[model samples]
Target: MKISIITVCYNSDATLEKTILSVGGQTYKNIEHIIVDGLSSDNTVKIIQKHQDKIAHWISEPDKGLYDAMNKGIEMATGDIVGILNSDDTFFSKAVLSEIALFHTKNTIDASVGNIIQHKADGKVVRAYSSKYWKPEKLKIGFMPPHPSIFFRRTLFNTLGFYELGFIIGADYELITRFFLKANISWKYSGITTTAMLVGGLSSSGSSSYQLITTEIQKALTMNGLYFSPFKIKMRFAWKIIGFLKK
Candidate 1:
């Protein structure tokens, strides 16, 4: 099965090359690497040009935001399965895509979620986030599998629609909730470490982002007709702390 992996970036020159190399090194051969750049002023486009041979489709232009760029990538994707990898992130191993392909080929599911490890600029591991404990019911508590580790069949997007452009931080939350709870899409845990993410991204930055996401999560849950409570959402942080401790 072909897998289309999308990488979105703006001024991501320092890290984009590694992300490209990770995808290029994948053991799975039938892969389509799509790059969506927000008209980066830096050397991000140059890096993309450097690895142009590895990419199947790419575009450099101004966009609304992250989700908008992702929507563009999704529109260009023609593979059987679609996945997103941030420009600052890389696959855990060359076998990562292979694992995803095998998992999908074996299991008749519409989507899959794996695991991710978050790290700092110095490469210090923060926590190992797993999808093993995730269930559709957990959306009420604002918990979700690592976004970078999730992959969906292209048909899911066609059936459910792309990421909602209305959200700033909760577009992914809204999309996941729509797929799992609202639309009742089939998904399974892949039991593999798919991506390694850099810390300090929008959702992982600090208190301000946390507060904003908390508010947006409420908005997302409400829009989906799911129950929402600020108290329940805050408890997700406690669960995160426990996961870090266990890690």
Candidate 2:
């Protein structure tokens, strides 16, 4: 299976190289790396160009935001499977892509999800996240998979829809909720860690970001005819604590 891994960045020179190199180091050779940059003013584009040979396609231009650039990468992707890797994240090991390929070759799945470990900029592991508790019916109860560790068939976008643009942080959440709860797409789950990310990302920290997440989750669930309750936000944190403890 040809998997297209997309990385989107903006002025992320310090952290982008590790992400690019992680994709380049994948043991699965059928992989294609597509990078979309938001006209980075620093050395990000130069670093991208340095490793351009390993990249299947890349472009640097002004974009609306992270999701917008992701949409652009989706448009450029030609592989059978599409996965987004954040600029600040990397596949956990060189074998990750190969493992994904093996899984797809054996199972007829529309999507696959794994796990992620989050850390601080200082490289201290903060917490680990997983989708083991996720079920389509649990969408109303504040359960969802880690976005960076999930891979979807390219056609899944056509069948369901692309990430909605207006959401500041919950677009990935909205997309997966729509896929599992509304569109009824089946997925395979792997216990292996696909990516290691730094914590305090858009949906992970800050009071403002949390507020935006709550509002967007509400909008996403309600608009899709699923139940939404602000009260469940605390339960979400409790579930996260369990994830941390399990790690």
lDDT of 1 by residue, 1-247 (tens): 9999999999999999999999999989999999999999999999999999999999999999999999999999999999999999999999999989999999999899989999988999998888898898888888978899999999898879999999988899999999999999999999989999988888877899989898888888898898767797977889778877996
TM-score of each: 0.96, 0.94
Candidate 2 local lDDT, 1-247, one digit each (tens) = 7999999999999999999999998888999899999999999999999998889999999999989999999989999889889999989899999998888788788888889899888889887877776676766756778888888989988778888997888888889888878888878787768999978677766877767787788888877888666687536777667867997
Quote model 1's TM-score.
Answer: 0.96
Q: Which candidate leads the pack in TM-score?
A: 1
Best by lDDT: 1
Candidate 2 similarity to native, TM-score: 0.94
* Candidate 2 colliding pairs, count: 0
Per-model CA lDDT versus the true structure: 0.92, 0.86
- Residue 156 of model 2 has an lDDT of 87
RMSD of each: 1.6, 1.9
